[model samples]
Target chain A: MLFRIIKRTDLTGTQAVMFRTAAVFLALLTSSVFIIILGNNPFEVYASMLEGSFGSVYGIKETIIKTIPLVITSLGIAVAFKMKFWNIGAEGQIFMGAFAASYFALNHADIPRPALLVIMAAAGFLVGGLWALIPAIFKAQFGTNETLFTLMMNYIALKWVTYLQYGPWKDPGANGFPKIANFHDNAILPKVFGVHIGWIIAIVLIVIMYVFIHHTKRGFEISVIGESENTARYAGMNVKKIIITSILISGGICGLTGMIQASAVNNTLAVEVTGGVGYMAIITTWLAQLSAPVILLVSFLFAVLVQGGAYIQTAFQIPQSVASIIQGMILFFVLGSEFFIQYKLILNKSILKKEAKGGI
Target chain B: MDFALLFAYAVHAGTPLLFATLGEMVTEKSGNLNLGVEGMMLMGAVMGFQVGIATSNPLLAVVGAAAAGALGGLIFAFLTVTLRANQVVSGLALTIFGTGFAGFFGQKLTGKIVPGPITTFFGEAKVPLLSDIPFVGKILFAQNLFVYFGYVAAIALGVYLFHTRKGLNLRAVGENPAAADASGINISLYKYTHILLGGALCGLGGAYLSLVYVPTWKENITAGRGWIAVALVIFTTWSPYRAIIGSYLFGCLDIIGFRIQDLKIKVSPYIIDMLPYIVTIVVLVFISMRKSKENAPPKGLGNPYFREDR
Candidate 1:
């Protein structure tokens, strides 16, 4: 496991920074609770998050590779999320990529590298985008709840992939289970300089996206739509178009991560295709304030937390679910902390206690 | 498969969704969309099993699940209402918290059956002579007490939402909190009360699963029923009666497909399992076709209401 970096966002002022600090402190306290539950020191569990992610060469490399997909997928969601679109089904979109890669690997096992890679990547992106389009179109046009819509999209995507892996798309030669075919040597991503090439692509995409978000008209329009649909509409922005396009791109990248996992890392698909990266990406992007560059750091931090979770489990015999718990706590603190960053708390003890006593 | 058998299982499958959707409808009517229904249901499943095991009473155990579910909602309310946090984030947090909380706590509670009500309640639900009726009576009327309550809740909630004065205020709050506030409605209290009450109902739905439907406590027992209920809120246009229809449709769709699998039909179980979610997305497409201002969510569904948004 890797000790990944979590992006530290600038809160813009010193005195106002107390909320973010308190959030981290609360997260620390929450992790300590797990430490107590695991029969270990709370400080140790946190140190373990750092130590496990960056403690060894292999761990660091793993963290780097894991962050690649996270960065890419999170960036995808970040594009929409920054505009407050809340595309929570990136995991399912990632599955689309994995499913596509698996399909390509099975169908064209003898294809050449460039041709296969291009087709597989495009297919993954398109499928992811299409998967996202279903919900986005509905959300943009049907008044359906996007959160629920995207969530349902996730299950559908998982089951769709499951159907294939278990049925006609199921690996014919392998025993029962939802296993996809192996990506052949040509289809598999070639590691350059001993690091996964997919990571390189992710890095490139980050720079490009950073430019796109800051320098482009579409990005500005996204912010407008997010701020208010009425305003965006008044400004002549095609709000639905933006929602659809953004979600589709987001889904496409999620698909790219799936393809990377299927071809570069796992070389096959499983239920863990997205590996909870979809939700993790949400937290990462949120941490980075939806800034493209910040995603890199935030992704790394989460990678460590996830990878270290296993170590803590082994060391203390704690259920690996502890990692998820810590994750939840972090998100809780991060989200709660933002309240402080945005709004200062007033200690009107008399009013609060009075309200409390009045049975409100 | 015999129509009677298919019908029976459909009723069974729909029970949890029935309970959850009704709960969400009530909450939404009161102007709060409690996205924590999934969390509430999950806690309900675990708590119901644990409590039922200790007390050896199915009804009492169900009450425990309801209470636990209410607690889950209460936490969400504390955050979103009193604490005035983001509703969407708070709801999502509740789900994450509940998921992890259940996973950690459920390690022991899972796999153990409660002492009572495995088959007794399901077995005892048949009417004296009504059981002899053809497809209509068997499919519609006969079931456990929970199923009957689901139907009653649907009708009763429908009336309470549309007929009553309080229901009008609730609708007023959901549509525009500012308007409701201007009208002197106590916004936070109604939101908290309905959200918690909705949670209790969701918990009961979850309890129905362990105590009556599945007759066992299974990990992930709610199994996206919460998600289904979340969608039902949209599908029903936030209406209690429509929610009932939507939930039952999903429930029936869920069972009919699965029954084919149990009968060892040639279709892929994976594909069959995908039916409900896939269909929901497809329906979402149809719904999205009209997703303009006329039929959209209340303007303030997800935004946290602040007395100071001005």
Candidate 2:
């Protein structure tokens, strides 16, 4: 018998929608099971999570606040992912970016706030881009594996930041905690209305990146590179240049994310300032399938889950680990659904034997 | 402060890394890099700690940890092997799962410390006349079981890969799976079994952390030793003996750093701490830049093998 690959478009339009709906619903169902396993009433826990995240006016604002950094970092990751460059060190890059930005903010306190902030942003972008560039350079020049390189770089960056936090950048008066002095008013990011300046930057970035990836010629080349580097090369697109350029851009945006998270939102840099958002951003980006605007939708829901998790913990005494578990579960189903999209489960030899034996 | 004491500490620290690197070496030789070793190590560390805590039997705890780590590897092999999932994603997911699971489980076992396995934690097992030797005996012969095992594994695995038939076949699978498949070797079986074995060894490495090195169970006792294991796999170019040398070097650097942290070394602790990762990165870059490096990764490394593709 000739083996045939299953066609993805074999299902009807409505069935396709139903499949997606059921998949997402299944994820929610599994998430509820986790809540139940943790010894909490699923409905009450979920309801309280919803209430805590969005029931009050301030809750929604906080959720929005959390979204800014995540959206920014994820959009950067999406750009790199689109080019098939796996930069898992974005967390460390963000740390480096914050460190670089904070250093400038500290040394250049004599400069006007607006100028200082711009310089800080530029420095962060440069540091982040350079951090990413190290791996990109390795990949382009020496064929070094970017994934491991980036991962290693993360530890290096983390240590670099920690060394400072524990030594030079340590809060001089606050005993021995790993934190830095707050930036001056000149370097502090200004808020617009109740929304964080980071959120405003995030919105502007989303629109620009969407246009860059979808409309521009360079963006078009990035998609080609991701599809097949050889094919892109055959088409005379400079694959190395594009990969390096895309990564630089991606890493730079992540730097801006670090700067904003430090200066605008938290007001000071801490070890957890990145808050593992950079890694979760990878999951969010993949869930959105790297669609620039879809990040907003996914991030919105992610923020809610995180917000809800805080509520669940406070209200039900559940471990904060529940949020991480829920994220993992969501990622599980989303990733698993790709199997259905790409391949059909056919009745193989044993299954065929079962069907033959079925008298009914 | 003496060479003998310093040498013993290096051996103790390097032993687990040696095992972990060797385990990763075997897997990479088969052309599948397992980044989940960190997660596996953490799981082993925690599980070993918990079992040792519950039963007070360190040997049984190592066994438990080895089994748990093998199970973790099986999960990785299943995902990348059976499902044809992206190996990197699956390995990463395994790390995530392993990390999260270990953290959750380890919460109960936190701050639980046990006595050091040996009388002085890392004393000796010296040969009769050798123990009296000035510098040589203390450094090489007088040490823990784990240290001896690490050397034995390095030598044994080195012999097996280069000098044995089964080892050749596994290397064959790594070098070119398609050709190996043509030669009627069971690529999938070799990969799955060795991967699990590698996982078990990695589990042992992790268990060593709790059982021997620190003699305490904590949330992240293994820390990032797993990543160092991955780096060592590459650093050694899959050489078993080189793994021992690399791990000891790393261990020595780390030990020395801690020993001299109080001395104003003109370098910040942060920059000093950054040395290992930076060194790893630089070494990898150097490895990549070498034009004549023939024993690079296996030819078919990381690419999924499907008979149908032929």
lDDT of 1 by residue, A13-130 (tens): 6754566667767877876775687567877776776777788887788778778888999889987786677788888899887887778877887888889988888988998889
What candidate 2 gets wrong by more than 4 Å, as runs, is A1-52, A176-178, A349-360, B115-133, B261-264, B308-310
Per-candidate chain B TM: 0.89, 0.92
Question: Across residues B54-106, which tens digit of lDDT does each residue of candidate 2 receive?
Answer: 77665778788888888878877876665565566566666766776676667
Error of 1 at A289 (Å): 2.2
lDDT of each: 0.76, 0.79
Give lDDT tens digits, candidate 2, residues A43-82. Answer: 8877887898799988888889878877999899988889
- Name the lDDT value of residue B303 in candidate 1: 65
Give the docking tier of candidate 2: acceptable
What DockQ, between 0 and 1, does each candidate earn?
A: 0.41, 0.42
Deviating ranges (above 4 Å) for candidate 1: A1-18, A31-41, A138-145, A192-195, A229-244, A347-360, B30-34, B117-123, B127-133, B261-267, B282-299
TM-score of candidate 1 versus the correct structure, residues matched by position: 0.88
> Please, what are the lDDT tens digits per residue for candidate 1 over residues B51-93?
8888877677878988988988887787777556656656666
On the 0 to 100 scale, the lDDT of residue A238 in model 1 is 81
